[model samples]
Target: MGKNILVLTGSPRQGGNSDMLADAFIKGARAGGHTVAKFATAAKKIGGCRACEACWSKNTACSIQDDFAELEPLLESAATLVLASPLYWFGVSSHLKAAIDKFYAYTRPGCKRPLKIKESLLLICGADEGLGVFTGAIETYKGIVDYMKWQDKGILAVPSVSAKGAIVHTEALKQAEKLGAEI
Candidate 1:
């Protein structure tokens, strides 16, 4: 079955370099005939996880109502998830990090029925080059995949892409299309 892919953009800058990378993935995924949707964190007021712990008693649903309530249905329907964010301080942008933390709403109390995410992907872009500038973000994403038991689809890290449209030379767009086609 074709997957329902959710691409969440975490960059604050409009049409920032990282978002361009995500657009590549979205275009590719759509071309492959999968259902895809993209959401920009900057445009939405997604707050931090409320830590109410009320989720357990109410079908893993949260009580500190906000935009998060809107995401539950999306999560339920998504078979593949892509977290796209620009590298900030060698970690995921604040918005995406908060989104991840909010995922606790999906956790089961008994730990018997593990959360399910099916398949997942991560797209990260940084302004500097280094062996592991993305290590922190990658580790965070891997941790989420582990919790959800999602398939390890792929992760692409692009370095030195600060200026908008700079990714055109990095082949990240082509790679994203391939990722979509494969998924």
Candidate 2:
């Protein structure tokens, strides 16, 4: 059996470590007969979500519209979601930050409702190996999981990988593949 999975690559660099990790995960998932819809934030033109409250008052979705309009369906329909991004200043890339902000539709007054994600994973890569490296990003990821009340599959954080494709260290790539296969 196959599942509909949405993979969001929230990296500023096309071939960055986070992107590679996402690709590895997607590849493993495909090999396991899962259907994946992969999108790169760097490839799309999106803006930060403005607090218009239009999705609640105006409609049942976001008001500050852009490519995100095309994303809502896939996001809502996916059985599993992989939010992978390179750690930028202890958090996700600006690209992903914007995408996440638009999810405000799910947080508006009328639009604010419980999200029912079947399964989810947070894949993050950072350059610093400090003990608290992933703390900030982990908080952000946990916030989403808590908001949606989604099944938290797991979280993978790779440290000391700053350059592109450097996540080959810290066992992140292998973990990503394993996560996909298991998911």
Q: Assess the local accuracy of residue 100 in candidate 2 as a C-alpha lDDT between 0 and 100.
A: 82
Residue 63 C-alpha lDDT in model 2: 65
Tens-place lDDT per residue, model 2, 73-173, is 78877888889998888888899888888877775567643344578888888888863878888998898888777788889888888887677756778
> What local lDDT score does residue 126 receive in model 2, on the 0 to 100 scale?
80
Writing each residue's lDDT as its tens digit, candidate 1 over 38-152 gives 8777666778877766664545466666666666667667788899899999888888777777777667474322344689999989989873788888887888888778887
TM-score of each: 0.90, 0.89
RMSD per model, one decimal: 2.4, 2.2
Q: What is the C-alpha lDDT of each candidate?
A: 0.79, 0.81
